[model samples]
Target chain A: MENFEPVIVAFCCHYCAYTAADMAGTQRLTYPSNVKIIRVPCSCKVDALHLVKAFEKGADGVYVAGCLKGDCHFNNGNDRAASRVAYVKKYLEELGIESERLAMFRMSAGMGFQFAQTAKDMTEKIRELGPSPINVAKAQLKGEAA
Target chain B: MITAERKPLEEIIACVAPFRKVLLVGCNECVTVCAAGGRKEVGLLASGLHMALLQQGKSVEIREHTLERQCDPEYVEELNSLIDGADAVLSMACGCGVQTIAGRYKDKPVFPAVNTKFMGASERQGVWAERCQGCGNCLLGQTGGICPIARCAKRLMNGPCGGSTKGSCEIDPDTDCAWQLIWDRLKALGLTENYVEMIPAKDWRTSIGNGPRKIIREDLAE
Candidate 1:
């Protein structure tokens, strides 16, 4: 019901998006606390399995935040992550999960506002989508009304 | 190496939709090298199915197992202890592996997760091209080692068929005319005389025309 709070997982690249998240903290920008950030070596390190596993572990939404195109610290890490995120999005749709639950974004360490904006946007979108189907199933399995 | 491609995800998911528990078997031989049914792929698929089935509230127990070679009985025997634990087996091997597993356990159902593609060689990384037809005939010596049966758009014996232009096949611009390759090969070997000689009609008895074919060597029989 209206009390539902969506869970979101964000895989942020250490060189860019992760640093941006730290910047947002220093700037005192407020974003949904439910969006948990996992700092990865590079956006490319965020594999398709990790995204799906997040849902399996009860996350309602997942996002991969990498450096802007051609700005990857490792010279194409963000490019690779962008495509991998696309692949996972299609894979999730086929698996019966809403494609809106998974996403990818590009940002720089200087874009603290953008990082906060992405967090707020993802939280809003996932809240509208309600809790993930996996979470609903898990709740039902425990004989509780979701 | 034998090549295969993973079957569409929906089809594979549907095949085990009836089962509450399933065993996922991957082969380490050809499928692994081809990036189709390898151990890593098995893990990817198993986790995916687990997540999907969980969302449906279907408590499906999916287990993962990888064999050195699914086509070999010795390796397949490894599944003997685990087979009974699952309702069905989903094989991520080629057709031969699927059949081998099915034959080993006649009582259990075996489903294929990949479609066997061909007897081919890797053209490059992640790219495969057919190079052998296994016509029960070895004619590579005559065609400058390029297989006409497999490479030719039309399995022509004495050809170019006049449809070839600039050494490319008429069927597709990317396809090289097999006869052009044969000519280039024969010329390089100074065997132009052999090119003009008739190859004669192939004996159909040695091929699939004689039903299934096999090599029965009594000397090597166990």
Candidate 2:
């Protein structure tokens, strides 16, 4: 487990988090490479299906990075995304998975440092949790097949 | 519309635990409107079930489908092809929908994913309140369009009872007293006379008190 490198998927809102990620790159801020960012028009555009699908597809950790509260390019998208994240967290708990595997983060377009920090923090958290159970199961199945 | 809520995940997981393949059916009618069973919910449940089962060291195949109306025989026929592949069926609809699927496919074991609550109207976004009991009769005319049989805690024929206080039912402060609402509506429409007129004791034959009832419209019958 100590050598495990977790896979984290970040759904970044195009108007803010995605731009912030670009800014981090330009500023030479170093974040973990484990975090893969999927740009969405708005955080609200990230549906529950997408979040669950992430885990189903072997993502060890998932997060939605949107604009700060009340700062959504489309008003309340971030808030909506937060509630959806909360909903899926309870669902993950029901599935016998750690709810902490999923999260919702808020930041503005100017927060390049925040973006980099969020990625680093999320990566560290998932690394401690180790690989997702779904991924572990898939590995076992593969081993059996081989 | 009919309202329902999903059963606990533990119960559902247990039901499908023995099966390797499951056919998850969702209704696009009442269950969809109540947000209990629909395309989106089917996807969420399917994914959740898949991961949950995998965690148990068992892999299950869950095929998802939503019908226009599960209670209709023609719509349920849509699952004919998929039904053959699944070992069991998980229905995410009201009880009627579950029974419809169970009746259509006798060989496959059918299980309900949700508990049918009641005939209701959406009070607001995400909140629904019971509105009718399907008494097989409509009494909205004399009750000022409010149903005492369904809304009144006692199902009193003439009520407000001693339990009415501050426009709310004594049973629960949050619940509005049906009689109070009836009085207010009657007063507003200048039909207060209807309130004082003695309403005869209701006949229970038309309701569930007797037995299951069915209606056949002769004109529409084939």
Candidate 3:
């Protein structure tokens, strides 16, 4: 018997998290293969709709990774994204989902260990939480598509 | 612009709980500007509602559409094709937009997802305050451009009521008396003499005293 695996989506900003992800590869770090990364120009570009849509598409967990506070490549982009992330978390709770499923993480481009650790931790957390509520419908839809 | 705030998620969920399918409509006008309802919001809401129902062991089909402006019949006409299979409509526009859709689709139940707040201006980012009451009259000419009808707590026409103290409204210490604002503007414009002329009693007929109001222009009619 095999253990349950989780699908986690990570929105990484170009200036920081995305670069860290590359650095992690260079350093030969290994993280869960289920962590799908989407590169965005800046963390602020990740809209609330995008977060919700990720879940709707059957992502068991989602995270926004950007530069550390006050360190955004585009001044205050990370700060603005932080506020949006907090607001989305509250909204997710109201939607009757676990707020912990969505989170905003801050790191620098040189922090390859942090990037690998984030992917590992998010995968473990989601594995424990099991599949998202919409996972069943998503699976059915996939079956129909097949 | 008409301002609105989204209703609590529970209330919106309750409205569509009975239906197996719903069409969530968003407006691209005032409600969008206020960050209450827009295209992005429509998608977010559709996802939220879907997940909420999914958690309850229910499978519901939700559709999302945002019109150019929901208050206009031309823009609303776009929904006719999409509304055929939906059980109910959850509108994210102002009260006028909700009524427009309800009036158009008489058979389908149209529910409002936001509370129509007021015809007002945003004081700052994400903050709105009442500015106009739409009393069907233009008294700004005489009151130094400050509207007493909307700003005044009692809607006093002549001067400050006895309740006013220290240039603030009696209702709340934080609120500035509308008449005081009128006086200050009048003083700055050297039009303080306008106060001496006693204004006559207002004609309530122009307001909501009668019923729902309508404006028809024969020349502009198609």
Candidate 4:
């Protein structure tokens, strides 16, 4: 029995991921609605603070969707996003949070099907991993016993 | 820029033991620029400390605070109320800021969260290279902006040491030979004449020697 319906945050870059999502909607590609999308100008603009804050806010998983490498509307934005993602993953492991809680994906604007697949895959992965510890801790604080 | 790196979370956690109420101090200057002891690092360090303590079944009140510049007394004073309830303070600044905390709060135990490396600059993102020895001398004009004292494996003043091989330092092949870097930089800038100038032995007297160093600018003081 699936117990946890994971709340996942998908940070979609306005340049690509957001456009890709629009395409997915137009294409009527079915993806899990568990993922909530936040639009940012560039993936490089996403900082470590944003990733940690999402988890603190009870996101079971966080994913950053940026343009394909070298195709960032803002030059090098995807590269910078890649670095931030890697750094935050290490940081999450260090913070006693499973680093897999954070993930990054690269796709062109035309890859609406791929975007849907990514969302579906990430939601399933989080389901397998179970609720994030931060969320569990919050629930306990709210007088709920695990 | 001063060279610095984050202390392993294990080491930092070990230092904070036996204290329940603790203040985590992050510096906004060198440590921040180095990504070792900045505000963001303060959060990361605080979270790690909290997780470590929780895992051990120990309750710790880890308070996070960052100063504009920990080395300055004014910034240290800003932490007065934030540290009032804490049993101990963990400083994520360089050695200078650590001493400042100790000097300011004589009653509390102040610990360091980063190893003060050397005076250096960021070679690239996530890469810091030691550039200055704090020898109380500036010799950038002579070295073509490549600091031999810090870059050279041997700190050779004149030229590349015999240990240099194929433009790489013998100590580590991945590291560019310091003299080679200097020569390339000078050639690029058409300043090879600067390399001909002899650099004298670093004088120990002018640096952190003869006791704790102090810089008092009477004009600026007013």
Ordered by lDDT, highest first, the candidates read: 2, 3, 1, 4
The residue-level lDDT of candidate 4 at B156 comes to 88
What does candidate 3's lDDT look like per residue over B23-57, in tens digits? 99999999999889988778888888888777666
On the 0 to 100 scale, the lDDT of residue A124 in model 3 is: 91
When summed lDDT is taken over every stretch of 10 residues in candidate 4 chain A, the lowest stretch is A137-146
Residue B176 CA displacement from its true place in model 4, Å: 2.8
Residue B170 of candidate 3: its Cα lDDT? Answer: 94
Instruction: Give lDDT: candidate 2, residue A71.
Output: 92
Q: What TM-score number comes out for model 3?
A: 0.87
**DockQ in order:** 0.51, 0.84, 0.54, 0.26
- In model 2, residue pairs whose N, Cα or C atoms come closer than 3 Å (at least 3 residues apart or on different chains), thus clashing, are none
- Which of the numbered candidates is closest to the native, going by highest DockQ? 2
Question: Where is model 2 more than 4 Å wrong at Cα?
Answer: A144-146
Encode model 2's per-residue lDDT on B3-23: one tens digit a residue.
Answer: 999898899999999998999
What is candidate 4's lDDT per residue for B99-161, written digit by digit as tens?
999999999999999999988777787788777886677676788887787788888889888
Candidate 2 lDDT over A89-139, as tens digits, reads: 999998988999999999988899999999999999999888998888888
lDDT of 1 by residue, A7-26 (tens): 99999999999999999999
Better of 1 and 3 by lDDT: 3
**If both were scored by DockQ, which would come out higher, candidate 1 or candidate 3?**
3
User: Order of all candidates by DockQ, from best down to worst?
Assistant: 2, 3, 1, 4
Two-chain complex of model 2, DockQ on C-alpha atoms against the true structure: 0.84
Please give the TM-score that candidate 4 achieves against the real structure: 0.85
lDDT of 4: 0.86
Ordered list by TM-score, greatest first? 2, 3, 1, 4
